[model samples]
Target: MKELQQLLKKFFGYSEFRPLQAEIIQHILQKKDALVLMPTGGGKSICYQLPAIYLPGITLVISPLIALMKDQVEGLIANGIPAASLNSMMSDSEQQQVKQLCIQGKIKLLYISPERVKAEADWFLPRLDISLIAIDEAHCVSHWGHDFRPEYTQLAILKERFSKVPVVALTATADKVTRTDIIEQLRLDNPQVFISSFDRPNLSLTVRRGLNKKEKIKSIVHFIRQHRDQSGIIYCMKRSDTEMLAEELSLFQIKATAYHAGLSPQKREQAQDDFIHDRVDVVCATVAFGMGIDKSNIRWVIHFNMPGSIENYYQEIGRAGRDGAKSDTLLFYSMSDLIVLRQFAEESGQVEINLEKLNRMQRYCETDICRRRILLSYFGEEVEKDCGNCDVCKNPPLRFDGSILVQKALSAVVRTQQQIGIEMLIHILRGAARAELTEKGYHLIKTYGAGRDLSYVEWKEYIYQMIQLGFLEIDYAHANRLKVTPLGTKVLYGKTTAQLTKYMPPEPEKKKTKASTGKKGFKAQPIRPIESESVDEVLWDALKQLRKQLADRESRPAYHIFTDDSLEDMVAQKPITLGDFNQIRGVGQIKLEKYGRVFVSLIRFVLKLPKLEG
Candidate 1:
């Protein structure tokens, strides 16, 4: 175990493991199967990568993204570890060379896609002395996952073929249903499962509702301009939207590009390569664009349109600030987006699940409470108080004595027999005299016309809040009926009272400024350098610049080479010797042997530290 810790410091530049990583590695080293649910950029790769180095024989990693595989392999090789990848993009000679390396016991880790694993397993399995099987993006195996792949469903063969070999499955995002499905689908044998916190404190969450196209585009442009030297992505709903938005950004001289499944393979590859190499400033793309991208320096992510689910939104927004630096995400939503997304769900053949997910996403966009709390709650994690970083916590809405309005809404539901949908109940509450309503005699009810002062949109928002607060329930499968829950009944009978935010009004256009243009209806806070009591801010920035320079020289993403957290550790410790450097959190042995002297000398020179006598 001490040797493993030393290896972590020597090779990966980390003195300790992230939460659950060391335990999972220890479990795997003990030949136990495991499942890990850490967020993206949570160091899931290290959990398996480090164990693969120490475990006898090669560990075969099953991943879905070729680009991700390439990035991992490059980083491993840069760290002086023997790693190789086999994908369709490799030439026959390249593939044969990789195979020879594996047969010669020169490669410690081999990354291959699930489809390649199935196609080549027959010939490939026997060539190497396999010790462990590590599966990345394991959520894809579950049919309920947002990124389901049929090929991933066939990965059960890994455990079936190698009955004794321990398998570890991992993913960044999975709800309870998806987690159970992945466990069953992968057929793990009593694997230890670890779920880390879903909260991303470095990511500032913001949401805007009903932004017109012009405003959204302007807002996106302002965001890009604010971070012009940095990288960002604008995610749209449609391919055409990507192209159009890319053009709009280009018109503003932002040097933007578009990427989607609609683009040709060559074009997509070019865009990805350019973005990775920092040739492109921004990418206006659809949700399909980010899953395979490994660039870690992305400064922000802006959703030009509403996504289908909170899972997708969280995963997409995770692309930003992967280095543990402060980053921002802006989501623009509208009612028409909800309608279109619902229609898409109806056409998807899995209507109930899709609609349920979509409805949750809509509620998230419309919620008046703490955004982070609601998001964490959806994934079964609970935070005690509001995350002050979000817009709601930053600028609270006007809360009124809404008990009367709540009683009216709930009472109208009962008076209408609790048999109708929200629209009908809303109509009755507003005292609508439509022909059907008149024939049904809904106007005669005492609660009829009770909410006449509120508009249709206001009533809808109120209903949404009621549902979120557990005051009401939607029988989604049964004509989408509105039913009063126990909480609603209490409110109706005066046993409970409620205070709700007033109806949302149209937001005035904000005057664009350096720090205020990233999000609509809100201003983005100035991104400050990482700070701690033990370190100087200017020195920390210098260390980051040094890390960036090293990363550029190696042609790797900055974080993949050395994370911002690692740099912060260096700045804090101010180590001037290899021994002292190894004491830093992320300073592994390989990094110390490779670039330790340069960093140590830089620190000594900058801080005027005296050299120790040999």
Candidate 2:
């Protein structure tokens, strides 16, 4: 433990491990297989890394994202830990150099893609000490997991090849079913599982129904403009949608770029690079973009089109506010998005979704209940009362008696032979004389004139609710027609009664408000530069060396222990004692207790001082 402490101080410039990190490290040191589910920025990497330094063999880290792997490797090198990644970017000689380092036991950790495991096992697994195998983003191994990668399935071979080596699997998101699948498929031998809560209070979630395509585009532009100079992403469903939205945002002179599979690799890389370096304010992209990106300042994630599942929704939104800074997640939903999503779901090749998941998603989309409450409840997390951040909470739309309207819509679908879509049904209800209505048969149906009392918009909203209530199904490719599913048939036959909620718009905000568009918390604190650099260049290089050593030993993110913020503050204040270190803002109690002593000691050594003045 003393050795670990010294190493932590020497490498990461920290005095101790984060919460639960020490326990997790001990398990790996004892050769116990562990499965860790930690939130983003929770120090998951350090769990296996700290042990890797102490153990006799080289530690193998299996990672999925090339960007994440590259970023992590850079941090490790900065901290003086001999770490190298074998990814697509490396040349043959570079790969050979890294392999030689591993073979010579000079590398503490070897990061490789899951796809490399089976193919490279014979080459490296035979010669390396192999103290432990750590699977980063372990959720990808599960079939039910949202970010399922085909390459992840090959990870199971780790247990088969290195049975005695301890295996640690880690991820930021995974529910019960996904958890079970990870354990079974990874072939773990009774792994110790750690599941962390998925609550991010700093992020506010909001879902708004699009008035129309043009209105939806306008809202996206408005939000990007609202958070000017902050980096963000706009997710679209189609490649064409991505191109058009990028074009529109560019027209408004927002530094926007488009990313899709359709783009050339060089263009895609350039766009990603631009977004990361702040050359572009926003990257309007398809679902393929922005996974495993490490840029810490993304302020918002806007979905111009709704994602297919709740899992995808949560993950995309999870990308924002990663710096523990306040962030916003805005989703633009419409009846058309629902129709398209449902049609895709119905046609989806996955057999496990069944009818239950379909109904649940529909209810979530149209529910008059609190949007955040509905979202959290879907994730099996509880949120009491309404979250005032959403459209439904901000502007509570009026609720008229929709029981009559629901009955009329369902009756019309049953009478019209469920193939007719929303527009035809709405026309028939509003008593509009369309040629298709006359061609279909008699415009004299009893249910046709029954809904004549409701306006076209009002009646369409009712149909949307009925669909949400499972009494109607809108098939988009089938001419955007409505089909009465078995459930709808039962409701029409009076075998079951539909309890449909009214569709309401968001409520307006109250009068009292902040005058500035800047974030509420986290005042604009001046960031201090490295003390040694400003004071004496030689001393600054010494401090950097010390930080590299500490980062290597602690195996924690260099940024986490003392963010560039804390480092700057350290140089500015030059605290010479634990108590003095506590004076800095943002140094919370947990951090002060764990790291105060080391930072103070470093300061005293550098300045040739005794105790701190304060």
**All candidates: TM-score:** 0.79, 0.74
Highest lDDT among the candidates is held by which one? Answer: 1
Residues 1-614, candidate 1: write the lDDT tens digits: 79888788667776677788888889999998998988877888888998999998999999898888988888788777899999999999999999998988999999999999888878877778999999998989988999999999899988888889999999889999998899899899998889888888888988976566887887777666656467888899889999998888878888789999989999998888878766677898987788887677788899988999988998999888876778889999875577678879999968999999998998889877899998899989998889998888877889887888889988888887887777788798788878877788888989889889988768877876787678888775667788999988888889978988876554544554433222221112222333333335545555655665676677776666566667767877888888898777656667777777777766775665876445
lDDT of 2 by residue, 1-614 (tens): 78876666555555667678877888788898888987665567778877877788789999987877876777666556788899888899999988998999899988889998888888677788899999998889987887788889888888988999999999877777888899988998899987655666567777765356787787777777677656888899899998898889888998899999999989988888677655678999988886657665578999888787776777777778766667888887777776667777677666357234555655666667677777667657796667777666766766555555666777887788776777788887877888888888748888777777767656766676777667776666678778877877676666766665455543333332223232222112221223322353323334334543454456543444545435556667777677778765335455667667766766676676775444
lDDT of each: 0.81, 0.73
Off by over 4 Å in 2: 1-20, 53-57, 343-349, 354-359, 370-400, 404-420, 424-460, 470-480, 483-614
**334 Cα displacement, candidate 2 (Å):** 3.4
Instruction: Give candidate 1's error at residue 337 in angstroms.
Output: 1.1
| Per-structure clash totals for the candidates | 12, 16
RMSD of each: 7.1, 8.1
* Model 2 / residue 521 / CA error / Å: 20
